[model samples]
Target: MTDAFRFFLTLLDLAGLILLVLYFVQMGLAAVLPARRLRFPAPAALKFTFVIPALNEGLVIGATVETLRALAPEAQVVVVDDASDDDTGRVVQALAAQDSGVSLLRRTLPQARQGKGLALNWAVQQLLNRLRIDGADLTREIFVIVDADGRITPELLGEASSAFADGRVMGAQARVRIRPSVLSLAPRTLSGRMLEQQQDMEFFIIRHLQHLRQRWHSVGLFGNGQFMRASYVHEQFRQGRLAWPDCLLEDFASGVEMRLAAPDHRMIFLDSAVTQQGLPDLRRFIRQRARWTQGAMQCLGYLPRLWSAGMPWLARLDLSYFILGPWLNAVIVLSLLTQPFRWAFGAHGLILDPLVSALITGVNVVLQLQWVARYQREHRLNTGQVLFTLVSLPVYGFALLLSLPLAYWNHFSGRRTWDKSSRHVEPGEAVPSMNGD
Candidate 1:
């Protein structure tokens, strides 16, 4: 092998090991912390505005709006109909007429569903207009962004409100999960449960990282159940940066944007605020993950700002690792895919050394085991489910994970189209609790 090529392989192996070490370190801290679980103080008194952005969400929009109404009667529910071809607009408009707390915002076709960032920016403007006319305090108000299919409990909502009690916590993300009843529902198959459990296990690890990251006051935001400080969000809207690049990962951009916009503030993870996220079938999961993976890549735009974000060194390091996660995952997958070819053709040295390859693989196994431990301690997963995850990990884990490469390829090839998740939630049906992850 050429000296330069050999150096490249060595460097790649070293970087992979460093990231794995950091990953274990963070998970270890999350594991050993005395106050690991989420706990909440009394709910706080704050004006809340719910912004539900819908694009052809007729299936679940009605139930989502109604649930929020019952959960927070005093909160304003703003439904942004993103030029839906379905009845999403009509249902929300009808509800608005019947209830003063609910309102509707309609957009034209060319603009609607162009991106959620645009829809959310419109809602933020409408909210500002309302606050001005009503003479409310923008700084003290809270803005909650829930997905069209989001199922949040009243308790989670209360905890979300209380998370901003400190005033410096600019954003809070909830622990998101798929409903447990899905396992017993119709058309349930081993593959479907595997898919759901894979995602659930992922959230288990992600929420723990966020919890650890929050100790340094550098938590990131998840879209479905994040609460943002009203003043901070308005500032972003006025700056014309509310939604970045057709709303590429709006939740993620919000966290980075908040840090740059408000130097005095920090973000948090509200483990107590759980949002029951509805999962699509296996076919749909691919499309959804493609968008998410691409969005993570697009968020690299915020990396420059993060360097000067004035956060602690640890927070900056954690955020940097997160920002590069998609690329790192892509590289690792590429390395693994090339190994077989190199092994057969006698160019094995072009890939990782055997010892290094085993080490990298071992790191992944240990992380999976750590996730199992976390699910046991937190989600109270039984042995059967844990075993299922171990077996299913190879399928659901790699399939979703390997999409990072596809996401990068699409972006570089100038493909940025987004497919909205199809809503399938039944009205008034019981959504299993998240118990704050």
Candidate 2:
């Protein structure tokens, strides 16, 4: 074996070891970090306007509206139907008629306008205009944006409203729980578990790190349930030039803009405010992840601006993490694949002993289990759902690997489209059983 090949294998092994250690460390942090309780204000005197952007959500629209009605009866609820081919409009109209607080708005996309960002911009514009005409104070009205598939308990809304009362808090992000579904294929089951791991890590670990640095500015805004001050959003819209910036990742771009424009405006991740949403089936899940990867790469230019714009050390670190994390995964995978070839051809047999590698792998498994247990407990996931995580790791790893090239290709080719995911439920219907899969 050549010395060069041996050196390369050694480097690869070291890199893998480091990543393995980091993964465990991240999991440990997630497990032991004391949960922060958001101080929500009394809801009696506060006014909230819930804004939902629906594009073919006829199935889930009714249930969401009803949930909101039960949770925030006094608050105004506006449903923006984004020219759905389905009966989304009719459902909202019926719901509006039944509940006076519920208002319906139909947005016919003009020739040039496209994407959820556009739909959101139109709805928010209408909201601002209505409030202005009504002579309502901008600072007093809370605006909540929920995804069409979003399921919220009554307590979630109240908790979100309470966070708004903090004055400095410009936005509050709710905890996202992926409702588990049964899948026949092992790959599909693994993919779902990987997603569950991501959610747990985001809420428990990543979010804490963000808060500690005072730069916890962004959340899963791709309509992961969030509430913001109407006035703040309006101000951002005007300053940002384009309403949603013609970007595939509108939520992320908006977060960057908000942080830059208002440094002190805190965005809280309300642990108690939970939203139940579906995980994509294996195929759609890959597509969704590819879109995110592409979007993140395209927005790399914004990182320096975010960093230089008076963000705290922790916030800056978080930004760097996202910008480089995907590539790091790619590197780790490549290193793992090439290690054996190098060992056979090179002088260095293996830098790390098999026992050490096994120990590292075992640690990784334990950390994953800890996260899965915490996630299942908090979200009330069933035993089958909990077991799915254990089964999905390799499948997710493969998906991650496949998504890298596709994301880069789309980025350079300038292929940005509103690749919307389909909703699985109908208005007022129970969540579909995963067992059918």
Candidate 3:
């Protein structure tokens, strides 16, 4: 092998190992990080406005609005029917007619369906306008963004209320959980069932990392169940800023902007979660993740601002690592592709020894099992379900591995739009309880 090529291989291996070590370090931190305690306001003390951006979510929108109304009967539920070609607007309007708390903001063709961010911005402006006219305290109003498939409980709002009790907190992300019932109700083959469970397992890991991020006060939004204060939203709007950036990952971008906009402002992680419907099949899962990966790539431009934002160093590091995650995967792709060439040329690959590589893989598997075990215990899964989850990890990892490149391909090929997930569950299906009862 050429000396220059050999040196490049060595660098790739080293970088790959470094990234692996960082993952383990984060896993350790997640294991030990304690939840933050804060003084929370009473439920009646503050107003909550739920902004749900619906785009052809006819199957799930009605159920979602009903759940929110039941959980927070006093809270304002604004459903922005983003020109859905279905009955989304009609469903929400019927609910609005029944309950004054439920309302719909119907958008027409040109303005609607542009992006989730635009839909959110339009809804927030309407709320702000009414609140301003009513002479209400904008700071005391909490705006939550819910997906049409979101199933949240009282705990989600309770945790958010506690976080916002600390005046410095302007944003809070409710932990995300994949609804198991979605899997049971949907007709699926064995592989499809496993794929759905894998998606749920992936969410379990995400929730764990969110806990660790709390230590750095760098919690981020999941787009489905994130909350923001009206005062903060108004401030951004007043400065001619989009409350939520018009991007694929508007939720993530908005979180980063919140941090950069004010050094003292914080985003907290909620202990409770907002359960979302699971992906019924592999195609939807990959498409969803690829969209997220591409969106993360889109967020890389904020790294410069993040560094100079005067936030805590750990917070900056954590956020930067997240935004740059896809780029790191690009390195992994190169390392894998060059392994055959390295072996043919009698040079070392990414990992020098076969046994060592096997050992590393084993360790990763054990760690994954530990995470799965915790999830099993928390959700009270049966042994078969636990085994199913364990078996699903490889499939899950493979899907993620595939998604990074797919995302890169899409980003460069100018294919930014994605297919939204289709729902099969009937509206009458019971919304699963928070504790998995």
Candidate 4:
């Protein structure tokens, strides 16, 4: 039994080692490889339609609409109010009445609040119909999805349009940054500040990884700040496979499908950013991340299609690794949980030798420090914030680790409803969960 446990520990160590090596190799390649180039068309020539999904987002939806309209006056903004019992619909309707470019799609009871994917899909259909009536060139039109709390700079639409100039590119995801003002709502404490900084750090790392993935043609969408071509969306609509309403991570599932749909299909990571409000508290953060984790696990259904997509082996490998992450984490968690038993049975030796463990630890620390350095440089963080971030990263990591087991439990227990996050709920108020996705 002792030998068996040792073998299990050894296997876990090897799996973790392989994952670490893969991460290093990808990061190295991304750093050394030339940037994936694309042609930029005049921003004036591109027609953008921004789709914002709202569910009881009365507080911020007005600002989001106003910001997008201010940034791109010529662009059409469509806000789909998913049966918000609040003034969400009225707020958007007022905006629509004030500007011809703004429109509101109100979903009623029974069909409302299904999922974000369905809301987006419904908005696209309405957009296509309106465009068709105007005899618009669908092929040249771009559809951008923005969350209700999302804000984009003036350069966002223009920068995003640059990718579509490359005929091969079908989708583009803008870099996502957490807005600092939202964190003001959190209690004034070191932990609260750490939460905000760590979220910023998380998005920065995500952007960097997306840049790395551009080489592998495996870039993903974050729901907010995601852009897709209208013609491609039209094609999906006609084929009855537009947006996935059931997947918890509808954005990710749609991304995978986009890649598999065509050989030349490419998704780029945009240099422009869309700033979003972060969860002000840990409870909301965990709920949001658990939903994301479960969504990734649900995406395992795409494995058969992914393997047969005829992508290069490396791309397939990268994607497979991503979709299979929950299972891998589960194994690692099992290893951690069983360590006490191994110690009890006198079978607790180092999974890797002290020297090897130290090397891995050093490499991880260096890589993380590199990320922090980049974040600090890009965001102009002071020394104190940098040091605080470095210290709090482990806590953030442990928080993410906690989400995985909860996600797995929820998945197995058939808890698939969407638990909406509230930015201004009072002390003990429960965030509401809606039907369907």
Best by lDDT: 3
- The TM-scores, one per candidate, come to 0.88, 0.81, 0.92, 0.92
Candidate 1, residues 1-437, lDDT tens digits: the string is 56665566666666666767777777778766644454455566788888888898876777788988988888888888888887788778778889999888888867666788777887678778878788888877888888887767767766766677766677778877766435553445667667777787778777777778877767888888888878777676677766323556877877777777766786767665555554547767877887887888887877887887677878778777777888887657766776775566545333557897788678668767877876777767688767776887788866786566667777789787767777665545653222311
What is the lDDT for 244 in model 3?
A: 90
- Please identify which of the two predictions, 1 or 3, would achieve the higher lDDT against the true structure: 3
> Which 10-residue window in model 1 sums to the lowest lDDT?
428-437
Error of 1 at 165 (Å): 2.5
Provide the clash count, candidate 3: 0
Clashing pairs in 4: none
Clashes of each: 0, 5, 0, 0
Which of the predicted structures, 1 or 4, would earn the higher TM-score when compared with the native?
4
> What TM-score should be assigned to candidate 1?
0.88
lDDT of each: 0.74, 0.67, 0.82, 0.80
Better of 1 and 4 by lDDT: 4
Q: 43-78 in candidate 4: lDDT tens per residue?
A: 537798889888998777777888898988888899
TM-score leaderboard ranking: 3, 4, 1, 2
